[model samples]
Target chain A: MTSGITRRVRVLLWAARAGAADHSAVFTWKTWLFGWFVRMLAQVLFFATAGNLLGPGQARYLLVGNAVLMVALHGLFATASTTWELENGTLPLLVASPSSPSLVLTGRSLFWLPDGVACGLGAFLLLGPVVHLPIGLSAVALVTCLLVLVGLTTYALGLFLGSLVLTATDLRNVVSNAALVVMMALSGVEVPASAVGPVLGRIGAALPLTHGLLAIRRVLDGRGGGQVALLAAQEALVGACWLAAAVAVLTLRARRSRRDGAALFLT
Target chain B: MSLLAAAGRFQGQLVLTHRDYLIDLVRTPLLAAVFLLLVRHSGQPQLIAYGLVAPVLMAVWSMAMLISGEVVDSDRQLGTLELVIAAPVDFARLVVSRVWVTTTISLLTVVEVFAVSVLGFGITPEVDHPVVLVLGLLATAAATAGAAGLMAALFVATRTARTFQNTLSYPFLLLGGVFVPLDRLPAWTHPLGRLIYLSWSADLLRAALAPAPVAGAAWRICVILGLGLLAALVGRLVLGRVVRMVRETGTVGLR
Candidate 1:
């Protein structure tokens, strides 16, 4: 971390190392495959049924909804899985080995990138024929926006959740579920905010998910450039806030743990 | 008279179950309220219904899985599985007694959710077929129980029971006709869902609730019954194997 490499360079290195550590630590490919298959199948079934009810025109809507679900769930997964590592006493070694915690966390998030992409585009392609998504540059923009906004939002939230384990015990389900339910609900992943009413409508309006999802939808319609930049900017802002929150929590926990003799749990 | 006494004794084991149920109800009332409110306009808005049901199903499913995991892990932690196995209490009765407690909580949660939805959301399905609606609700609960039982067994048997609880059920919630209808799935994924108990539960619920007439009611019942039976059998078989494995090689932490 201190070999005079720039901070951005160090962060990338940490991210890659974190990804490697996670893959190596949790070497349950069989279980991963099983869980992945189950989720993919369930997602496919959901969209197929939704398409049946709304017709082809609404297929893109359902596809985007599913994409948001993937992002939200992945965020929870990455966050919880990382915290579980910390709680069980494996994260400290990586943290102390010249890599910043932030970089390592980012690296661990890379594993989900492929799956996230697949889930986002796979749902679209699988349901596109049924829904008649207009093929063009906008589709690319739609996928890109989803990858960045939804993806970044999830990563930041995951880090935030991971930070909670620093001072708390037995609050995993409560914290994880609350963060996920709010994110999913506010993001309008399950239903567009338009139908949920005024109070929730306002709340959703303030969140990044609504904008991120809307941006993706616009991209799907083949609109790009300035609009995409604006949407990305909104997502980046939300992501930055969440990222800051996660970092704050992690730093606080690290300081407290060191003072409390709980540093033994680190590495 | 002896049989009655025995049944009474069995019921007595479930005394703690009510407190458990009440505590959970208190904790999750907000979530339940929010869900029902969202679904008030489900009839006219398909997306709203999708949003409402996905989280509702997840909340309920998580409750069931968490309770079941608690049952299994506590037994494992306390090394009481062997004690319970050695006891002369009827094994079936033991399972039921424990399940009765969790199942009761789950049912009460469902009822509370429905009642709140009705009172708050003003959602009134045509009582033109109250019997069918009740039956549909019953089948849904049964299916949930079956899935819960199977999950319990799976977790009890596996080293990674905790992870399995989340990883396994996450998929079911997504495809259980909560967010999207079953018909939307590709033909290839249909067989996969049919293998999961949630598919059957969704089918039973949709048949009962969706503004469609019930056809082949007898067949639907059979399908529900078949799933419930299959789940019970599988759970038992898996538990047996897991117990054997645990006995032969001491259980260790999941990797």
Candidate 2:
């Protein structure tokens, strides 16, 4: 059992490296930077311009919200990696592998943590001077922590959704796009969640980014560190729950697929 | 079957087989809900109208560009590009037909957005100039299809068609003034915005829908129609050249 655990760990790391390399191979440096930096700048500018029309304070709020939301977008897009396996006709091979499917799915999304962190950091650094975000050393440290938490939470959610791809291959874009729209709507990314209906507000509370966003706003407002720490812990707990749920769901589905001989078919 | 019938059948197949097209159909309502919920506190009829119309225009633009951009790649992927190219048909017509079908399907968003504005927000968009509004919608649809044709031409020759297709989404949204006025953008971007037909379309739309008569409505409409014609012409020329080049190189389905 110990050896088996070690082998799974090795497979997880190996799959992570392969996933990262596959992602990197899709773009040249120019395209990557253009997709990441330029596109992000455009999104920020668009929201900032729109926010300006709403109110004076809205631009700052939207700038920060969208910057943080970029981390979630990275995580959301990472969930589509399983669609690549389906497209390449390798999903069956993956299902047939002796390694645990849950671990493999977890590993496949492991790179999204660093990718989301980089995107979050890039959005912050690039937009800070332009949007005049309060970026002192303490704010930076707090935001960094927030970014890490947001990354882990979103990546865990991505792994959860990625496992669903095993059952429905065509759900990749629908899941990603719908998640983005819903998250942006409910998570106070564009507007305060409180302004939304009570039902959506409660839904936002359960989401990972909501507390992290509230904490980021507090940090910017020069609130005490205890609040930020509490929110960060809440966000981490949410992420851990999502990761555990994903593993459980994937294990159940994989076992059923193996028994029913449905693992090889696209259905 | 006639070319138009064939295209219709193809679109029907897409609707049945591909969930993306179905998602595209509902995108405007989803976006409308998001935008309306965000600005529900404002309770301004004009703001709600702007929010409603913006997503309708975005839906049109996205559907047009996606259908146009993916046609060549989809054909290649399905191993039918060479057969299609070898057939005695005008490739540009085929592409234009597909884009028109997409544009028609996307027009459903216009109704959905309007309904959201009325039912959800209790705001009815004022269309003071009904004639001008109708004319503007037609011009916008034509211009969008034309732009998609041009993008389709560009996608046919590029190896990284999907990346390029994805990259066009935000730039067009930002520059076209779908959600914000072009004047709000930087001075340098105004000229670039003017170059896109959607900017002119948006101008015409706002002028038609505003409570008071806005100036330059005629000029904007004219410019949009002219740009649509120019784009379709350029797309035809470019697509012809690219197809010929592909034929010469025998690389129709290579990408």
Candidate 3:
């Protein structure tokens, strides 16, 4: 990008532009609404209706659980999109550049952040009445912010998975889809973490959506600040761990590529 | 029959080697796991039999919607639609065979769900009518393939087929009562739900697992087969018109 010091920042800006370009290529606004947004609505509707088997109370639980899952779903797409640079043949060029490749990879997925929040928020505001969520205006505002945290955290896990996909490119879809399934199962979307027993409960606690969801639930219940703050903090910590893992993996790959004259990404 | 077998063998190879087709392998069971989890957590673990069978049936329907739903659109995007039509092969049969293979793979969810239920939940699934269950499985697989073939024809008729695949997923899933029984669904949807082959398959499989004698199993099985045959026949006729429309409009290879 630029010269010696600020090259990282320059590459990040360039990566954002590239990500935006990719986004527009994939979706026109209308198709994005009809294609992606409508699917989210249908998915939430399916799960909420399935809750009818469990009665109305569980139906409400499912509506909230699945609607909040919209954020993690969109955000974890960063996992697949992270593999895009390599698929398009720009990955080698970035690896050969002076700026660290990790910088570019991390920054590009930022585009998914806001879209994810909107999905989470839209699902709630649209379907909440059917579930009859007792959400106040202030709570909606706060939950929107909490959804941003969920997006960032899930995207972090996605980036780590994406880094792994740099080598196993074919697993890109497999890995991302499997991860989505895991989030759906273990992330408090289907059943409470405690209900899944101790081992899975620990995993749900560590996963991205579990705490964020608890926080959202608390906000909707008009609970006090302490629970929300604690859960949010736990979510931020989980995200930080995943982000650190992603950075380490990327940095290691870059070092190995430099040592072997760019053999890592040649795959 | 040999032709169908050959076409199916070739398509199965592509599905194994290609990531696009193979991802369905993982997604089917994952969906089953979600159904099982819900069954357990919602205080009705006894309905584990329904939970186990539901996702397998749903997987067959999903294979129809997600894979067969886009078979034509995929060829259209690659400019292979006209070539595929002009070839010596029976295009409808080819599509049916390929989709049948995919739905067969989806049926493998039965094994996976059984393993998961036995292993994860310590609940061993029971089958009351072994003959009915076996016949139901074979019939369901056939009907799913036929449905997929029909979906392929319909998808090619519309411009938004690819995107429509995404939207088709859950709504059809809900309407078809893939998880819940049609009676459990709203009353108005019952007629429409009966039209889906999955509703029959789901009921058949659930009946086989229930502790009572399965009545009208033969009739239900026949209906599934009859619907499947009708779908395949209609798919062929509709596709003939689709080919003519594309050729006449001079957009055969373009869109």
Task: Estimate TM-scores for all models.
Answer: 0.74, 0.94, 0.91
lDDT of 2 at A108: 73
Model 2 per-residue lDDT tens digits across residues B1-255: 489889867965775587766666656777888777756654444566567667888888888777756776677777888998999998889888877777777878888988878887677777888898888898888888888788788787665655756667777788988778898777999998988888877767777887787677778788998998899889888889999988898877664
Better of 1 and 2 by DockQ: 2
After TM-score superposition, what is the CA distance of residue A65 in candidate 2 from its true location, in Å? 0.8
State the lDDT of candidate 2 residue by residue for A106-215, as single tens digits. 78756667766776777778777766775888788878888888877877777777777755667777777777777888888888887888998998887778888888
Task: Name the runs in model 1 displaced over 4 angstroms.
Answer: A1-19, A24-34, A54-56, A90-115, A134-138, A197-199, A256-267, B1-74, B77-79, B82-93, B115-128, B154-167, B170-219, B241-255
DockQ-based CAPRI category assigned to the predicted complex of candidate 3: medium
User: In candidate 3, how many Å is residue B160 off?
Assistant: 1.3
Better of 2 and 3 by DockQ: 3
> Could you give the TM-score of chain B for each candidate, in order?
0.74, 0.92, 0.90
Candidate 2 deviant stretches above 4 angstroms: A1-5, A265-267, B42-45, B160-162
Write the residue-wise lDDT of candidate 1 on A181-236 in tens digits: 56555566655676677898887765546677777777766776798778777877
* Candidate 2 chain B lDDT trough over 10 residues, lowest sum: B41-50
True contacts kept of each: 0.18, 0.43, 0.64
